[model samples]
Target: MAPGLLDRSRTVAPPGWSRWLIPPAALSVHLSIGQAYAWSVFKPALESSLNLSGTASALPFQLGMVMLGLSAAFGGTLVERNGPRWAMTVSLLCFCSGFLLASLGAAVEQYWLVVFGYGFVGGIGLGIGYISPVSTLIKWFPDRPGMATGIAIMGFGGGALIASPWSAQMLESFGSDSGGVATAFLVHGLVYAVFMSLGVLLVRVPAEGWQPPGGKRPQEQQSRKPLVTTANVSARSAVRTPQFWLLWVVLCMNVTAGIGILEKAAPMIGDFFADTSTPVSAAAAAGFVALLSLANMGGRFLWSSTSDVIGRKNMYRCYLGVGGLMYLGIVLLGDSSKPLFIVCAMVIISFYGGGFATVPAYLKDLFGTYEVGAIHGRLLTAWSTAGVLGPLIVNWIADSQEAAGRSGAGLYGLALSIMIGLLAVGFVANELIRPVNPKHHLPEPASAAGQAEGTAGHEGGAEHKEATGR
Candidate 1:
């Protein structure tokens, strides 16, 4: 009945309680980044059509990941200052451009173009897009940061589910040859641009006094430092802390352990059964990839939520310590049974996914949520480091083994052993984590004051319940 009510509703979130929309906005961006996981689908096509080696063809995906971490770390402060809309908008433009540019590279048979487009440009998008909604969501859903993050992150893990099948079909329809790969990349770029735009436009931050329903804390309540409070610990101060470097080591080790399998999933499976009675088929190997994706997605939610209960430090203990045991089982067993190998690999990969999902929450808990987005952006440097390290370790070990005429589980024994060692290192790093110091606290601003009361109250209740409750 109101003349402008319909148009007004569409323009912005209704004044009181529209922060609920932030999660969907986050999903839109994450779904697109999720496509990053599907890069393997293109690898075979690149190898076959361009006559490229697995390592050469992997450059774009690898570089893209590097860029993702680098850009996120380098540009975190900008995202914080500019707000999610601006950050997300850049992500849309760069990500789309990366795809479009890669399409051109594929069409012309210029590999570096794909490298520059997808790796550099699109990687930047991935980084910015990844962190854009993080602080915003944590702010909006202070009580259930884990769940809110899981809602969007689950889409990221699932993004590849949609992308892998869709891309494979596109490759099939487009003929899997060079031109088809070009078409696929082009379409993917354009389509994701459209998909991510919905997030940029629809996302809204909480107003000055807004709080999560039933989750508000009162002012004047003492609160522990948030791990993600960037204002207090600038990138300079953050890196200076023992905790930051320790986390870096922990994340890098965890990521490297997982990626050792991810980079060589197909060949690894194939190698495992190269001498078996019923060896892995091409289809079976592809199935393994899909299974890994499922584990990755499941782990993101499961492990992160587990951290909410078990505490971040202890949860990582399982990731690195028990994770080492899993790898040991895989190494000792030697793919003796496909089922055991698959189960072990899946569990390890899930922990990898969980590590990723939990890190943001870890940052939120340690640094405070004020500038969590920026702090997380900076911490992504660990991701960049692991991206390169993980693949390099796997591929290098595999390559070395191949050169030395090793195959199957024999080639990976060395790699898995290395992962076990690295995870042990991460365990030490996890142990080194401690509460952030008071020197990192930023003075509260007047604008933040309105929300501070409830924020502190909720935190106080949690601390009391956590520290002293029966």
Candidate 2:
């Protein structure tokens, strides 16, 4: 029988294929799944049509985020074993079908279906798709892992840019009622299904022993950087290391600091200027949120690429160290000057986005690429934890302040201070990271053919069996 279509062996790149094609393939799936960020666009319509409260309508988005972490953590090893082709196919089916199932739920007026379909089913797609391109791109462009992963991940941040307006316009044209919501969901499912198919068709794994043309080999590069290891660490070994948990704390703290502000951007801005000489209007507040989104998206690519030059450790120093200072600037001078406040907030948000884009390359530097994708999936548990922690801290503080008759910028002073502390903690954690122990490295194979077989086991199990006529 011919090889299966989604099998890892089937997706190997031809000799002399350009690696540049990989980013667009990764972008297709990322951009499609990034629609999760635009969940807010549907929240109002869901609340009004279903006659549910604000918090009730938020259940799907919150649950989706929770599941994104869970599925990525649990399914990461399967992704590595199966290859990007299999993983991407699984992602496409789950993500698109989620919308279709959710559309049906809305049409029948059963809210639970929407929650299950969109939150549970669709979130698996988000988790798997999110990490699908990470290892492939890293292996293809070991010369510039930071820039390569940055290019694909930037699409995730920008996805909200395309999705938010598109969703809003659809709701406007289709009338925002239960029927219109169903139609909108249906359209989203169909459109994304087609778009994500491009990724499945175009994605390919580098041929075994492939190296970038005219670039230093990964071993050569690792010789100069003490932190960059040549030995591979399995996903199981990675989590047990102190380095892994340290990076986890680094990611969690950085994400918490940034996401707290993001979750409350519009309202936070309005309150900051509520009693100023020129109070911010609703339109201006909305514009501020847009500007923050642009900053977030732009920073992912720019800062990650910069990490290629400055080194990952130094890049994170800027993220957590300078990020904390930015928060302090806002707390100290925000009320006195509007321009200063906006600029500071933008910088802080940019660092937040940068933290996400840069961490994969950092992981690759610390752990060899052997199981980096699975390691990445495991690392995303931090994102899930921060998702809840960040918002809870900010919202809880704001509520307490409000009860005590605080208003304006004063309402956020304590929250901003708390963010600074978190960044400090992250900065320390980043500093604590060191090289993994040799005890944890996968033992070196005795021969070249044996090494190739070992790699094939992780890259594509069937390839080795076929090569050996097993």
Candidate 3:
């Protein structure tokens, strides 16, 4: 941790360096921080050991998510100003330190300390880590921004696949008591520290003037794709455009629709089959949750990469449009066929994960890579909104229905219908997006050195021009 080691200048890729090395570096940070998705694995054990209510045990994860949005939104520009290496190092320190602090809290049986440490401190790490490599990846692979982002982001979705079972085994071996929880937290902090350090060391910005082999210039790409822009928009200007808010709505609605089912997946499926001839066992419900996770992880890479070919807007049409059909299928056919139900649910979740992975590329297309990371960070406020909004809609509706003497699939019927409506709104929002106005474009820098400095550590030194409306 020398003072200059994490500086942006230190991270410039040497001439002839392969840009392909970047993805794995990005993945290292993403996979470690993606453990946030597996926080549920500790919830039950924490409740048992600390004598807490379910809501209370959930505080850490919930607060962590809130902090994730806030930190990403606020810390984004600083990330752009510094570099991915600096951001990754900061994320590693905060995330690992939070775990270590939480471990101490668990050992002392001070639940409040655990909440503050994991929720507040670790949440900062999640936000910063999530955005750290995004711009860099976009820079290194401008020709394939969608696929480049997809690879790193897919690791975030997949992190729980590794963490959940591994954490469970540790809990089983050490016991789920407070002491065991402490030990597990200690191990997690240490292990993630080592893993995330790789990202800090390996990440590099493309040297100034570098471009991918045989890649089309931004203007050439823009000729075919109307939404693609050669002009850059500062993060500040991006937020002022109608396109930004339109995308915000698109992301929020898509996430809300998908998360509604995801948060309630286990219980919803079980409830669907409760009055049927074949009841869902607890084990089967658990397996169903696992299936959703896999779909979520796989979809990130698959759908986002597909966006590179089909375009970001069309990719979202599939997510929000076909996704709505999936919800309708669930609502119309409820409990009649288990296989169909599983298939529909899996499709919805896949779209959910795809939406997350595809958005950075979407931002790059509309905003350009100059400050796309910061723009992406600002857009994540939609996710935080959806996180709260989705669960509440499903849980509240289900509770009301059950109290009204509902049974079987009837409990979630209203909720599924609501998700369809939200997806339709998102679909409309997606269709409305167009090229950003020229008025919002960042003005060209006056001098060559100044211009080069602006684009140097970013995507490339492609000369920028004032955008003319498409």
Candidate 4:
């Protein structure tokens, strides 16, 4: 697509445009970036071909995650100012080029190049691509923001499910050697570059005065529930609010607890059952991982959509409250029964995925849709923090406990106990949340401000313009 053709004003949806198409645009971006989760499929190949240690081979993924969060945090305002089309275009270039660069790095036996390509370049793609469609989706589906985000974010969870086996098959057929890995990387870059362009082309911002079919104006809706404040908070202002930090803690703790288990899932299963009557084989462990992926994908859609009906805060209460209990179950009954262990792990992962999908809408609820993409981008710092912290806590504890003669569920007890405490703290933070103070809301426009001061009759109509982004 031509760069000039994608001007933000030119990309606004027509009056009758269907919002259903928006989710697919979002999926095209998310599904591609979500391949970050499938980096493990390349780990053994990188290690074997380059003769690198496990820690050395992991640098690309770790650095990529850190860059994902940092780039998103820094680039968020640019994305909002330039609009989704611009963001999607930049994401496509960086993401695809990273893969191509990584392919070259592999072919030349330069591991640092691979790290730079995928970690730094591709990680920027992951961050920008992840947030590109969020504000657009929220604007299009004002009445069902949670469900809209669920559809898009669910693609991120499912991306690994699609990529892992597909990449494995490609590696198997081409060969697991460095040359073969390069070929796989080259193919991935080319294919994803083409795939992600669909988002760049299809995405649209809502035109002025656009609303869902027969939907009421923002003022009318807010009048029905005074709690749903109709006010904008800039990203700068948002970060200063107590609500933002509370949410940061909520997301960080929830993600930390879930990711710890997910990071060590396949091996954790093996160890937990190693001395039991039913030992989990490598194949069974793979199946367990697949089940967790399914639960993750399902929860992104199911639990997030449910949040639309039940309210974002209430749904998170279920996530932390019930999720904490599920972890307790795993810690207590994990060694006794395989079925119980599997069930508890599945539910916990579901909540983990659900938390990611629902948070954007939660931001919409608390901060308003103005600059939500940027706010959401800033909030992802929590994920990066948890990404490092969660794995460190779990892996370090498990390793130290094993060295000290602990085995099975005992290795995880300390981690799970810590997770429960984090959840309790998050629950309290959620309870502390209240509506944003009026002083923090965006100043009313001069005309709107004048009308409100001059006449009570004009106040509703004036406020409606500001609230609806008209």
Candidate 5:
């Protein structure tokens, strides 16, 4: 909204710019907005201060997730047109303002205001910010799209790692009451606003003729096989393709499986051994949660980078195929052996995190980078779907079986079985992902020029390199 904010001339990267800087620019936004995951740190405090039930306290977070998916799906094309600077700035404003509004809501004890502020407003920020870096990163690192995106998305996973402890410490230093929570929200808004501006200022789109050092055009590189089509698919056309929906199912199932474990990490371990000889302790359960966080964060970088070597399709095969077997191992072996449980859960979570990190590159592979950001944005609805589905599948089965007098592992048996089934479905979908039909490809000249432009820019060509310290 600032004057000359979306100026096209400012976005184009100068010749000889270091591509490595792009990751940090992307990370700046990802890390700040990724604080959404740390909402759980506020959950208990909200419940206690507001005298709400567990489910009631979770509404803001759940709504935020729902809004995140919806906003991303709707705003994807806009992000492509507006460029990353516009998207990141918008994200910064909305994200920070959500916290401030939520702070006011918490201070006044108006639960609905908190929901409107954090859930509705903040969700928009998450969606825009999440896709802001993808297209740019892919363009900047055409040779390593997977690694570039992994670096940014990994920050999203790691953001929770930073925020969880930071928030806990803040609450401890202040007080655990409503006032303290309000203060925490206020501080988070202020701090993150400052932090995310780094991305807005630093991110750049490549100049029209720019290319990575020694990189060849798709035609020149014909001898090498690419994982997906070099042909461009418009975002609209991309959605019409079966590849889009199949990948949707793939992402949805993968996320659902991960969220199943993530949502119940602290309690599930304890319950698994409650009536068993092992008798898991509270500290052990806490450690399990920490382990999952580490795995989730680490996997984002590790597995996604690996995709570059193995190809995106094969990488997902490992995620869904190998991941399903891990779930099966947990179902049969987790209750009986704590070591096995931890190992399986850790690996499962790695695949889960891997799934998130890899999807952008996968989209690029399938659809091309022209609208990869927008396509990726539309695909995040699957995450929103999984957010609801994962927890539902786990909780519903656990509760139903518990009421039926099942105990320990028996309570989770049906749920784990269902998870395996979902993975099987995802595996089939991944296999179904053939190359996009030639019908969907953009004709040659326009497609070549579009890709050559590297990234979209605003109409006015005013300089913005000053914003990035050029």
Candidate 6:
């Protein structure tokens, strides 16, 4: 045995000071970054001030989403190379700065500048912040990857819950009828900057020899794979594989279906029964939006955890297959019944959040954790694509129908048809997934794979020989 090699390995550490503490820090960043979802709250202001149509007003949010995906794809490898603390700190800066910049743009009455600030700059923050804690969380909780991801992702979903109400109050307090939105933007920037900085200060990578309280082994004591994993494929290579493109299609389709409903929630519900004796009130429509948020947030944890038990494949089948049926129900029956509409919408959103929470774990399954971040970043391109597509399908159909003097469920039939088709495409993509090639499998130490697959019982055959809790 090489004597010096053993000593060198002892010097470095794993990811965090403690896994439990990390989620709080991560939540701080996630919750603040979540204000992006609240952009809709400003929609009426943007429309009235800028004199834009529904479609035009939605452009900034769509651009931000596109930028989010693109920046993540580009920054994924960089985040892995650095660390979560650095990545998230930078995200805080960009996001806060975007708010400040948008405030200036709004005050001066330049919508393009607002778009540039919020969409491009803030979107970068969203992407980097979203991916930063993911790999670290997985390292800390390998056995419960789904659960770990669910906890953090729930913050993303819940962000809107906090922001919508808070932003509404801020607008009332600080805003004059003339420039209330601008003042609200300024306050948002200042507050988030302070809140997110605390997270940056608290984050710390684990000390040397730190492991979960009762991890399998002193990692060094075991014969494990090289410190550097081998089976990871280049992002370029990942796209070429059937798996990458398939999953890309799957994510895109799932997100597109979900976002379509989200973008049109109020109007869609209103249109569903314009023909009815009793029409939906604005308050009821708002309640529907709240319900969707609840489903989205809850699904992030519940459905993703189910993936741990059922496996990623089976879970996604539930997403696409069952999700497809849910959409079909909405289309076939129309939105005549609130019970039916609400049920379908809730199930679809749960799958929507599940799709996001499951992807990182799915990436770990296929690409190996070595380059999962990079692969994840690349896959976000599909999200960027869907961000554009989803809103377009919804708004375009609704606008076209409105122009033709149509109302009620008739306005949504075409959009539902499109959503059904997307789910079908996703079903095909899900079926196409296969494990990554063994060539990409990094060589592991004898102890790591000691008990061959299936040999390990419900209780793992040999616990990891990792060290004490850091």
Instruction: Report model 6's TM-score to 2 decimal places.
Output: 0.83
Query: Candidate 3 vs candidate 5: which has greater TM-score?
Result: 3
Error of 5 at 152 (Å): 0.8
**Clashes per prediction?**
15, 0, 0, 0, 1, 16
TM-score of each: 0.84, 0.95, 0.94, 0.92, 0.93, 0.83
CA shift of 450, model 2, Å: 11
TM-score for candidate 4: 0.92
Give the alpha carbon lDDT tens digit for every residue of 1-470 in model 3.
Answer: 56588766788888878888899999999999889988989999999999999999999999999999999999998788778999999999999999998999999999998998899999999999999999899888888888889999999988888898899999999889999999999999999999999999899887767777675554326448888877778787899999999999999999999899998999999999998899999999999999999899889999999998888999999999999999999999968999999999999999999999999999988987778889999999999999989999999999999999998899999999999999999999999999999988766551222223323533222233222221
Worst 10 residues of 5 by lDDT: 457-466
Task: Report clash pairs, candidate 4.
Answer: none
Error of 6 at 385 (Å): 1.3
Which is the better candidate, 2 or 4, if ranked by TM-score? 2
Q: Which regions of candidate 4 are displaced past 4 Å?
A: 1-3, 216-227, 446-470
Per-model C-alpha lDDT, please? 0.78, 0.88, 0.88, 0.85, 0.85, 0.75
lDDT for each residue of candidate 6 in 153-246, tens digit (9 for 90 to 100): 8888988899998988876686534278788888899999998876676555444234556655322233442221224444545666888889
- The runs of at least 3 residues in candidate 1 whose Cα sits more than 4 Å from the true structure, single-residue gaps closed, are 1-14, 43-56, 105-112, 176-181, 216-236, 273-278, 399-407, 446-470
Q: Which candidate tops TM-score?
A: 2
Q: Candidate 4, after superposition: displacement of residue 356 in Å? A: 0.5
Model 4 residue 200 lDDT?
Answer: 93
lDDT, residue 407, model 3: 80
Candidate 5 whole-model C-alpha lDDT, 0 to 1: 0.85
lDDT of 2 by residue, 351-459 (tens): 9999999999999888877778889999999999898899999999999999999999989999999999999999999999899998877655412322232235454
Model 6 residue 67 distance off true place after TM-score fit, in angstroms: 1.9
Ranking by lDDT: 3, 2, 5, 4, 1, 6
Weakest lDDT window of 10 consecutive positions for candidate 4: 450-459
Better of 2 and 6 by TM-score: 2
